[model samples]
Target: MTDWRSDLELITDAARQAGAVAMQHFRQSPEVWWKNEGRSPVSAADYAANAVLETVLRSARPEYGWLSEETEDTSCRLERETLFVIDPIDGTRAFIAGLDTWCVSVAVVHLGKPVAGVLVAPSLDEEFSASEAGEATRNGVPIRVSRHIAGDHLRLAVAEDLLNRLDPLFVRDVERIKHVPSLAYRLAMIADGRIDGTLVKRNAHDWDLAAADLILERAGGSLVDLAGERLVYNRAKVSHDELCAATNADLPRLLRHLGLGLQG
Candidate 1:
């Protein structure tokens, strides 16, 4: 098997290049089109960035299967032992609206688990990366999740409706952060300890979570379902249901408040 560190290096470089491509269209009003029956938007920048990623990554690792948000899905990836999962530009709506929270997310999944991942947000001048065997880093510096124990005011990035679902008394001590349009960057915030945790709505896909999931894990955090199951990538069904991400120490408390059983 190939070294995960090397794979991390590959995807980091690809994400940087892809991010650069996306930046060219940032705030320039690149053409946009809707997909998922107009529920989602895809911009010319997305296709351009996807092209760059496909060219660089596939050329370098021809044998690895490919699964990208901008590319048509194929069953071929499920048959491979490893594959590249990508979101050329995560947070397309934010990107179109001239927000800097967007990023290029890429991950290498081996045997259904992420071994290497990278997220490059050119507008924010940030690059987050990790390998299965190494610590997570942002701009070359190691990062860790926030250590929040009982009695500390929890800082969270969650949708309002989801927040409302939690008992009012349970959330009374919580500090809700403004919504971050980019899910990948939102998870990165948790990984780097910018916030305590977040509740992810259902229907998130592999391209959105795979890369950030690895980064969060290496940074002493986890992204898991209510049942406390860590996600598995490169599956035939790429979409995920409601999930939560937080530091290992705080995950159980957050889950308990959500009325989910303790982390498994």
Candidate 2:
């Protein structure tokens, strides 16, 4: 098997370059284009960042298939043993609004699992990464999930609608953090101990979760669906429903508290 640490190094550099491309257009109000009938937005910076990332990542591994938010999708990637799964600018809405929450997200996925991943948020000057060979790290320092979350005040970062759906008693205990625009960054926050957890809405694509999933995993945490299944990468259908990331002891309770698996 190929060493995925080398893949991590390559994607880390590529992610930084992509983040730099996005940063060049940040706060400049780059042209916005709508997808999903204006419900989803893309900007010039997104395309520019995608271009830089594609040039670097694809050039380095031509045989490996590619899946990216900005690129045209082909079923070809499903045939490759390994592939690059990426989101050039994960929080395009935040990027457009000049928020520092956006990130250049990339992951090396092998056989429907992420082996190496990199996330670079240039605006916030943060870089997070992980490989199958090692622990998750931020700027070279190992990071682990903090157990303090289960204490008196549980810091939660989630949508209000989702928060409102939780039990009133549970809500009283949570110290809700303001909205984080990037789902990738939100999970990283949990991994690096910025927040305890977040409620992921449905329809999140693989690119949004793969990198952060590995990071959270190595950080002594997990990002799992309502039924407690681990998130997978590079599936034929790339979207996912609600998931939660927290330390192992906290996850099942969270799933129960949120009423996520009650339907079954």
Candidate 3:
């Protein structure tokens, strides 16, 4: 088997190609379907992109396993040493609504952690990637988390309802940005210093966060559960808790604000 870097090269290209495939159906009114009792939506653009990704990635690394939002899961992948975690078009609603916040998210995991990841947003002309040993990059340029913002001036990206969950003292100190449909892109924004951080609602799956989590980690930040525990992937239980991503300097304050990580 080749090194993880080789897999990074292959998956990054595959993700970009997959983005191209999705863009073709972006605003063409592709078919749509509701899942999880209509609480979630999926579109033909997502499946089209997944097909492109699976063909290219599986062909290049036949020994690896596969898991995707658009494809049925197989217990067989749980037995493999490595697997691909993918969300073909992460923001189906945005894509269907002709918005441009969606992207193709792909990550390779080994031993419960991501070895490499790639996120491609063709419409936005942005591509972000990283490996366990490489710096995070956007469009091939290294990226980093934003500096600490003074109190009362923080720009956070989170659902408005979550704000009410925070301590009123902290809530008054930060400004919330508009909510983004693509959860992956929301995290990516932190990697590029576009936003300070955000709170993730519970029930996010591995495919929704694996790629961008690594990108944010490499760029000097972290995505951790309310307990302030780092996220792990490829587990039998694929869903995550309500998590938050932030730079190291600001994580403690955010965690305290949310009434988490306050005890020893």
Candidate 2 displacement at residue 250 in angstroms: 1.1
Pairs in clash, predicted candidate 1: none
lDDT of 1 by residue, 1-264 (tens): 567888888888888998988888899999999999999999999999999999999999999999999999999998899999999999999999998899999999999999999999999999999998899999999999997676888998877767777777877988999999899999999999999899888899999999999999999999999889999888889999889999998899888876432222
By lDDT, the better pick of 1 and 3 is: 1
**Model 3 Cα RMSD, 1 decimal:** 2.3
Compare the candidates by lDDT and give the number of the best one: 1
Q: Rate the local accuracy (lDDT) of all candidates.
A: 0.92, 0.88, 0.89
Error of 1 at 97 (Å): 0.2
Q: In model 3, state the lDDT of residue 63.
A: 94
Q: Model 1, which residues run further than 4 Å from truth?
A: 260-264
Best by TM-score: 1
Query: Which regions of candidate 3 deviate over 4 angstroms?
Result: 1-3, 149-152, 260-264
Instruction: Write candidate 3's Cα lDDT for 56-93 as tens digits.
Output: 99999899989898889878889987999999999889
Candidate 3 — worst ten consecutive residues by lDDT sum?
A: 255-264
The TM-score of candidate 2 is 0.95
Candidate 2 weakest lDDT stretch, 10 residues = 255-264
Candidate 3 Cα deviation (angstroms), residue 218: 0.2
